[model samples]
Target: MNDKSKSVKFFEQLSWGIWIWSFIALLCVSIYLSVWAPLGNIAALLVTGISFAGFYSLSIKMRTTTKIEGQMLISNKAKIDLKFIKSATALDAEGFKRLAGVDADPAAFLAINFWSKTGVKVELKDKKDPTPYWLISSKDPKRLVKALVKAQK
Candidate 1:
């Protein structure tokens, strides 16, 4: 069973003015290449098309939902759903321990490039199909951890 205490959502969208300006710039560049340099036009068009497609794919993938529940962490996206089970804490534990038999700092190891600046750490469990455990950085880190602890109980 899962008990969702909090939910976070993130979206990627440019402002109207920025989007318009970007479109205009693209149009102008396309015109210049098509008239002034026909050979380069094909390469430019292909590159621009690929770039737009890549951005669109990234935006779609970035749409995600993160839910922290009792002993479970859930990350949902358009393609797949990931689940992570919490590890048991010791009688006298300081912080989250590294995965079984693995000697790496969970914080440094799970730090991803795209979301690293957000101060979030995501570590995978040691199981065959291990789930990812995340330590998200928040202005109120204590409060967030407390909330997760309360939800576990």
Candidate 2:
């Protein structure tokens, strides 16, 4: 568990390798279009540059924003309070699949991304809240669970 008075932060982001490879592929396509297609050099460059910039910007914003702050779990799509969290457990790929598929609660909130093969399941304790739990995809599930548990204190 984490120190009761100390705040700990945990974050997850898209793999840089994935981003680089995607950019490379996009570059290749753009170059091919510029050289062979009727769009021409200037138009192709502008289109490709804009497209790449938009994609990269959105990806970075979305990926990097998923983080834990103090006792709050902050993601691009949701913010969760650790006080409302009863327990947190890390899940591997198969476990994630099973829980999300067969054992999923209809009232649970999910902020899952397929790029991550692991996740953390947080059971909610707040009876007043209709949400049963949360399933959040993570690049580092163990660390995330640890952080959540620590924050619980």
Candidate 3:
């Protein structure tokens, strides 16, 4: 990690623990089915293991972390320069929904997770990019917006 970079993870570790528990439940179902079906214990385990690996891999990919490094906002889907960012504001649940839904710009980048109801809305200053802003979900929108403002300076 760079000293100047501020990292904010969108999900709590406990939330990720749910995924692990879900995987265990799936494996249990597989084991139970193996007893009544022709698939057998080994086959059931193999199939469940493979499926779980793929599911976990995708879950890891979907987990997003936002990083404020120097003048840039870096994440899985977008990298935006703070120089082009006119403002960063923390949104309430209603504001987040409104900005992400009816009032949203068609060209703006969005990295949203259904679990997170509040977010940070970043307005782009550069007219050439076509994207008016970015709406990114965050567990702590206030801290994220603050970090963005600090990085801008």
The candidate that achieves the highest TM-score relative to the unseen native structure: 3
Q: Considering summed lDDT, which 10 consecutive residues are worst modelled in model 1?
A: 88-97
Each model's backbone clash number: 0, 1, 0
- The sequence of per-residue lDDT tens digits that candidate 3 reaches over residues 7-94 is 4422222124465667667766766586538867777777767766776776676686777755568766578777898988999999
Q: Which stretches of candidate 1 lie over 4 Å from their true place?
A: 1-36, 40-46, 62-65, 69-71, 76-103, 106-111, 118-143
Please rank every candidate by lDDT, starting with the best: 2, 3, 1
* TM-score of model 3 vs. true structure: 0.78
lDDT of 3: 0.74
Better of 1 and 3 by lDDT: 3
In angstroms, how far off is 106's CA in candidate 2? 2.6
- Please report the TM-score between candidate 1 and the true structure: 0.37
Q: If scored against the real structure, what TM-score would every candidate get?
A: 0.37, 0.77, 0.78
Find the 10 residues in a row with the least total lDDT in model 2: 1-10
lDDT for model 1: 0.41
Q: Candidate 3, which segments miss by more than 4 Å at Cα? A: 1-36
Is candidate 2 or 3 superior in TM-score? Answer: 3
Candidate 1 C-alpha lDDT tens digits along 59-99: 55544444453344443421212233243222111133332
Off by over 4 Å in 2: 1-6, 15-20, 23-36
Assess the local accuracy of residue 8 in candidate 3 as a C-alpha lDDT between 0 and 100.
43
